[model samples]
Target: MAQFDSKFHDMTEGIRAVASLADAADRLNTIVESYGLETAAFLTVSPVYEEPSKPFYVTTYSPDWVKRYIEKDFFDIDPVLRHGLRAVTLVDWKEIDLSDKAVRTFFGEAREHGVGKHGITFPVRGVDGDRGILSVTSNENAAAWQAFLKSEARDFQYLAGEFHNAIGRIQGRPRHQTVCSDREIECLKWYARGEKVKRTAEILSLSPRTVRFHLDLARAKLGAKSLAHAVAIATERGLFFQKLF
Candidate 1:
């Protein structure tokens, strides 16, 4: 018991140490692989339904699957994800009703894309209304799948919580702001170019305090956890391509 506890501790610590979202995704893949699972994904939903959904995902699924999933906007209707988002406890895929035509079609496509036959989703409810779902899938037969879940479900929940907390720590705060002023845009550009507040202030002939203020506003507008995340969001939206680097 002590040995297993130690190992779990080490694993969660490694997750907390990840430096980037991509690195965190890779780590999730590693974790699922270690557990003999086929694939896994951690998904976060934006509170406002109409807001442009930023890529807040970590998944071990194939690129083809990822692209198709996005192109189809299938997430809005995915039974596993929809339930997990609202479910207070872990949701097992096998237990859910699959009688609906749309649900059947969705699962059929999922299997074609190499998603496994069995799965479970652990919902994570965080402070500040942030929510996420950690899903694990496998190709195992029904009996074996149930046995595996009985043994591993608790541990999976713990790992999901750790990963969520790590991501939250990196993100700094719950992002919701979505507008930036002209000066804020300027500050973000300079910051993206590796300009510190002091250097950017000098270049813009503004005080360091003013430069920082603009950057902070931009970060909030972008709903970024940090300036680095703000830069990533801007780049994703073609905000950086407007000006020559």
Candidate 2:
């Protein structure tokens, strides 16, 4: 997995301190801005297996645009929103065939109020029929946007899950307790690779006892009966990223 940087460390810490959904949405915007994206939205609806609920959103979209969207009942014609609700993966704007006149006009009106020309939406499905969307927009040209997506798609997808889980907790839904700390993940990475406690310590420049301590914390948070089981849980959730160079 990737070596944790100070900026990423700061982000994890910030989430831990998030006071409300609006705070978390703002944090989401800040993270995307570093990638040259302009704004973001987090939406909650129902998964296809269940009946849909009135969608709720925490977004950086302009108030006028959001109001217009609701007043016009735009979700009925919103290609992005319609596809995103049932999408299992990241949905690039270009992937949707926007040949319909109504769909084009909807997005065109959105741009007039501040929506970016290009965007991507990540669908996050949670337990108890909970479904969420994390969408970010940018004004970058196709080539540059493609390059950004190639390198960052996985990261944005992970962020969507985090946002969904965090909002769920705030809304009284079941909370995911398996979110590991940076150091906890680092120790787990080595352990997953079959490193013994001592070797893992050397790899992280820490004492063996310290490495074991972090591993134990990770194991407990994951509610795994063993360290290996914890690693398996993390792997299943795609928790690990590329290792440091």
Candidate 3:
């Protein structure tokens, strides 16, 4: 493996240069290869109206495995996914509460599909109520796995955060536009530039509620599930930057 610092620096720059979600996902595969891992997956689920919307996932796992996982609806019983939803910190696959038969069966099936016997997952909470998990798996023995974790867990955590942020920037959006008004566009523009809701409201000389209304409208128009997602879509489509000038 390359020196940790150098590998991390390279991965950071590489992810940033990616122009689309597909490219970002490809870069993640490269990063995982550097770590000698068998697979890596980035999964995000955004909440809408207090319920989790559909999951958006990018993974280097085999198509057959992914197909079976979805066909069987294994997500509901997969300990990794279940724990990742509520975990605030890194979780080793071994540490998950897998007393349930369904959970054990899920892992057994995963291993049968070459999904690796060991892994660690980082659970991420985005600022706009988006949840994500960055998981890397290995088929290594216990001793080797422990040593690798001891030496590189921190670097992997940093990589996970960077990978998640990169996906946030480059993920595609719906092509349809719902005809946003000038106020909605203005609010989205400021929000995309990293302004807080209150700050954006102040800049636009509008009430916070009004700003939120416009932002929500903009999100709906763009067919985005979250505010950050909307901003990403808008930025990617050059809607905001073009309007700013």
Candidate 4:
């Protein structure tokens, strides 16, 4: 039981206000692991506000799929992303049909990557801001998944909402805004390990000067008074993945 709470404590420490999109995705992935999910995503409504729109912000997606989705400009016609923006409840992916040629193609690729047929998407709507969706997915059977959701859905949604709000505030938006990168976080993680500039540089294959630059950027984004403070904030906010130094 102590071990169980320790896992939750790790989660609580790692989900901080990230300054990059990749960092946000990484954090969501961490949460997904706790629930035995293979994948999770947070998709937000685009500013277009037109018919058949898609989420402008979709985290931790395959680069290939994201590139294709953007190249094809699918947001102009994706039914799921459209419905997701307006929904205020958890929607099962299987319930939606994508018989259209384009939709089928896109979803087919996602399934090929093991996204699974069963999924639950939590729709988060904000008043006068960018609405968002936090979805957890697995290959588990639909009925069992639904039962689990019935028990834990509201709490998960509430937490997702709070996380969404925090991300928005950091990005200077009321709704959703994209920020953060993998490298920035990688650098921060080294800092959290108590590595000095030169040492962290050697570990990351970056120059000592480059290490300082990334730390500076991290500090500014986290509103930290110093490097130590930034590390503390990141740990408190769930930004670091490894054991804290």
Candidate 5:
């Protein structure tokens, strides 16, 4: 029992040290692979403001599924996702019906890919009004997959939440916005491009005083001691989409 306890502690700590979303996903894939399970499908969703029917944000998903879903625009017929949002706990795909002809056709096409027929989806409620879903699919029976998920539920949920939070911070949509805004984002974008405040002001047809005001605001929003520090913060938060160097 002591040895088992030690191993559990080590596993938890090791997973916590994963620094990026990609790292976390790879780690999860490795874990499932180790158990002789093939996890070909994984997806995360967050809240989207427009379209009440489509309030969830699909933060990440398999590239193949993304293209197929978009090309087909199956969101309108994705009954499982629609029902899952209303469920209070993790749901199994088998429990939801795809009896509708359109829904049935979509699932049939998805099956041609490696995506599983059944899976468990964990709903993640974040700080503020944001919410998300972390789904894992398997080709096996829903009951068997659910049992496996139940055994590793805590670890799976932890990894999912960590991934989501990391992405949120990188996407500049963190639960707690330390320093970020539209003005700060604009200033940082210009700063990254090697533009001085005077030149930036001239380009924007603003006075030097106004440029300084924007810069100051950016510094405050970024929690930076200087203009350079602010730019660094913005870059890490994914505001600078282009390569600076």
Candidate 6:
């Protein structure tokens, strides 16, 4: 029990030591390998809806497989991704519906590219509506895979949550605000100061249409529901008036 506790503590510390996305990716790969898995992936999605924002993905998948997956737009038909999006707990790849032809084809092709024959996925939902999935895969046979999962599933789930939080810290606050542009920030700032779009545009020497465009972009980037919401989020993130008072 003491040995297990110490090892778990070391694992957590290793994940927390990740200083960048690249480092996080490497650490995740190492963690999976330690469990005798062949590959692992971490994917984060914003605005969890039909057409989510561009997902952030880091994986030990072969470059060829990754390129093919992207070119074929396989995300739409991937059973793993579909299940991960809706599942609240750990998901065994076998639990996904494989009756669909597209799903079968995806798995067949993935296997041909050296992807694992068995895997488990952990789905996470953030307080702010962000979603993420962590998957670890192995080429082992069914019996061995099941036995391994029985022993390591709990640790894998813990590591998945740790990886997500580490990524959040590396990404900084208001995860969506990482994409806010200068113009968007300026528009939000002026709007926060009680300026209308027209007045803000005049102050910035731009057209009202242009000002509204920036503000709309800011709202979208910040995942806010409205202009007031956008300004409020930006203000909370200290994104407004960075140079001025």
TM-score to true structure, per model: 0.65, 0.69, 0.66, 0.58, 0.54, 0.66
Query: How far off is residue 9 in model 1, in Å?
Result: 2.4
Highest-scoring model, TM-score: 2
TM-score of 6: 0.66
Instruction: Report the C-alpha lDDT of model 5 over 1-245, residue by residue, as the tens digit.
Output: 11234433454455546565565666556545654454523333455553344342442245787789878877667765666555534566677776688877887877675566666665554544455556666766666776876565544544445545554654467444323335446656787689988888887787776566557655644547788887887777676664233
lDDT of 4 by residue, 1-245 (tens): 11235554465456545656666777887787787776777766534454545444645556776777688787776656666777744577777777778778867777785666777777665544467777777777767787867555544654456556655655567543222234556788887777888999999898986676567555644556777887788778676653233
| Better TM-score candidate (3, 6) | 6
Q: Which residues of candidate 4, in runs, are more than 4 Å off?
A: 1-16, 46-58, 174-245
lDDT of 1 by residue, 83-174 (tens): 98887557889888888998999999998998988989977666455677889999988888889876666667666766776666556654
Stretches of candidate 2 exceeding 4 Å from the true structure: 47-52, 177-231, 234-245
- lDDT score of model 1? 0.75
Residue 77 Cα positional deviation in candidate 1, in Å, after optimal superposition: 1.3
How much does candidate 3 score in TM-score? Answer: 0.66
The RMSD of every model to the true structure, in order and in angstroms, is 16.5, 10.1, 12.1, 17.2, 16.6, 15.1
Cα lDDT, model 6, residue 222: 67
What C-alpha lDDT does candidate 3 achieve relative to the native structure? Answer: 0.75
**Residue pairs of candidate 2 with colliding backbone atoms:** 1-243, 2-242
lDDT of 5 at 220: 46
**Pairs clashing in candidate 5?**
46-57, 179-221
Clash tally, candidates in order: 1, 2, 0, 11, 2, 0
Encode model 6's per-residue lDDT on 140-173: one tens digit a residue. Answer: 8889999987666655655666677677777673
**lDDT of each model, Cα atoms only?**
0.75, 0.76, 0.75, 0.64, 0.58, 0.76
